[model samples]
Target: MTLYQKLKASGNPQAVAQITISLLESHSVKETAKILGVTPRWVYKLRERFRLSNGDISACIKKRGPKFRMPNRTPEHIENLVVTLAKETNLGSKRLALFIKNTFNIQLSPFTIRNIRRRYGIHCRKHKTLTGSRRFATDFSAFEPLQLWQIDAKHIADQSALPPEAYASIFKNKLPPFQFTAIDIKTRLRFIAYADSLDFKNGLTFMLLVAAWLRAFGVKHQLFFQTDNGAEFGGSAGSRKRKLIQKLIFDHWNVSLLNIPERNKETNCFVERSHRTDDEEFYALNLKKVTSRTSFLKMAQNWILYFNYRRPHFGKNMNGMTPVEALKFYRCFYHPAIGSMPVVVLDQLSNYTSLLFDISSLPWDNLPRNKKLLNETMAHYRHSIFSTSL
Candidate 1:
């Protein structure tokens, strides 16, 4: 038995108390044993342990052995194989545990796999360190409104994080769940579309939807569309056809292309971080409500509406303002043409402008630094535009 187990299994609370007092008092070993009603050998062992730990009582209680135990009673060779697979896949703990169960018939919980990952350097952080030589980084802060956009897709598994009926629908051949996301880097405006499959065709369709939506909203701005080296976004996919995305960005939308470095997902950290936010705030909470694909689609649409207009974001540019507020602020502060455009554009933005829409009303210098974004969120005060649900 380990030292801690042996010490705890003895069930002698008074013994440890006596040892602590003895160490603090600098009592002799004989005096400590007599005070604690234990043998001299036990006192000597405790003293030795205490001295080894440099007078730390808590460290003295810890057992000297391996910290990690393989999950699901997995064999050593199989555990090694799991680590190897982790090195390749870079999956999260629960996904890695599921992989182990499906591939080797070993049942491991997410917590166990997390411990195993911490024990050995098998996590994706190690993957980042592996390629820590040199690479370019994206500055999500440096872009102006409509200066850059990011688009990406996320996949929801067939039988993961759903109810029983949701589980029963996997009949070996069906369209899986996927979501196409587009984000404006400056204002953090997010648009999302759900699809059954991931392809360049879907990428084109989503970009067209974004362009059409922007056109309908009367927004005219040049931007660069950026994506990683994924096959979906016309990257280094080895001749799988990328002309659709190229035409969608360059010809139709008139946006430049910002290609991310190979194997460096952190370069696209904004959208990637937002995906985790969606997973936690939306997907995990709505698992029970999602009964079918249609319901899932509706959920995604509503989430985008909330994300765009309701949710408050805080940053250097978007301090204490929603995406809509941030967008209005940038346009009002930067673009005189937008202010002088047709009354329709002014009307759509009037809800976000201060009373009278006068430049004199702008308290840019009078207001504190933190309150400078206030004039942008003020409406016409005649009606609340966001009263109706999207």
Candidate 2:
């Protein structure tokens, strides 16, 4: 039979391999058996011996070449490549693999890359499944915006560690600078700022700043300020700094101060969420190292602006409006008579418009000046004013 008929009858490459060995035995029993690593009797039992096909016997033989130790890329090299990609792209392994192949001429399987990255501590989700029953201290989703705010402080590096000197300093004094942040649960707007020191003075200053921000937004509703039991937030110590925040909330707006259990930062998860958002958006972004306090403050201000005005929050309670828009709407509700007038009518109140008051982002130092002016104005309007409180 022709090699075509032989190949067709063989069924597949394995059959071809076995038959080819059997046919070679008739040419030289010892040599064929040695090459095929089989007994001559076994080769003869196949019933086709010394039968060389006229055409393409070489094609039926397996192709020969040096196979790669790693067909695509080494696991070590792929791991290094994935880490580099994650730091640069902040993307998952599948997209990162495609990017590496397209951008760097390196090929890697997504599954392998994912395992490598996860082994190296790259993960998007913050929480993992619990093996035991998990207990929640509070129902976080129970309230709307302006009802509650979660506050916390996270430590960050003063500057990026570069190399030998940086590595040395990191080992010697590894603690990062402090960033105090607050998140309005209802609106999900993050108010973040940094300070040189996280002492009592700075803590009080932070509360004052927050109070000023709330005043600027003209939020009149009572609020609940939740915080972890940090010394800065006046844990069981009942420090003056803690009292200041409480006093400001109680005296100014009648807001409540609620402290999370000691060491249980998750109870105030909204603040942690804000911190994570800052880490992903600002810390992970390619920015110059914060060399000076001034530079850090500037970057922080920019981040807060983005948080308040630009970020598209996942929470749908805000009617698709950003935090700034929600603040504006909240102000309208706080003063319905003035807000009831159409913008065109209120446009005439341009100079004296109640809406002119900023409800957020106000500087703390300016609040006292505002209060003094407000008192004087209220005295002037006392005879004509109809309301009990201004």
Each candidate: what lDDT?
0.59, 0.57
lDDT of 2 at 220: 67
lDDT of 2 at 194: 57
lDDT of 2 by residue, 284-316 (tens): 452335554445556666667766765545454
Reference-based TM-score of each model: 0.48, 0.48
Model 1: how far is 5 from its true place, Å?
11
lDDT (0-100) at residue 272 of candidate 2?
Answer: 71
List ranges where model 1 is wrong by over 4 Å.
1-142, 158-175, 236-249, 332-390
Tens digit per residue, CA lDDT, model 1, 200-250: 445655655565556555566666777776766666533324443454345
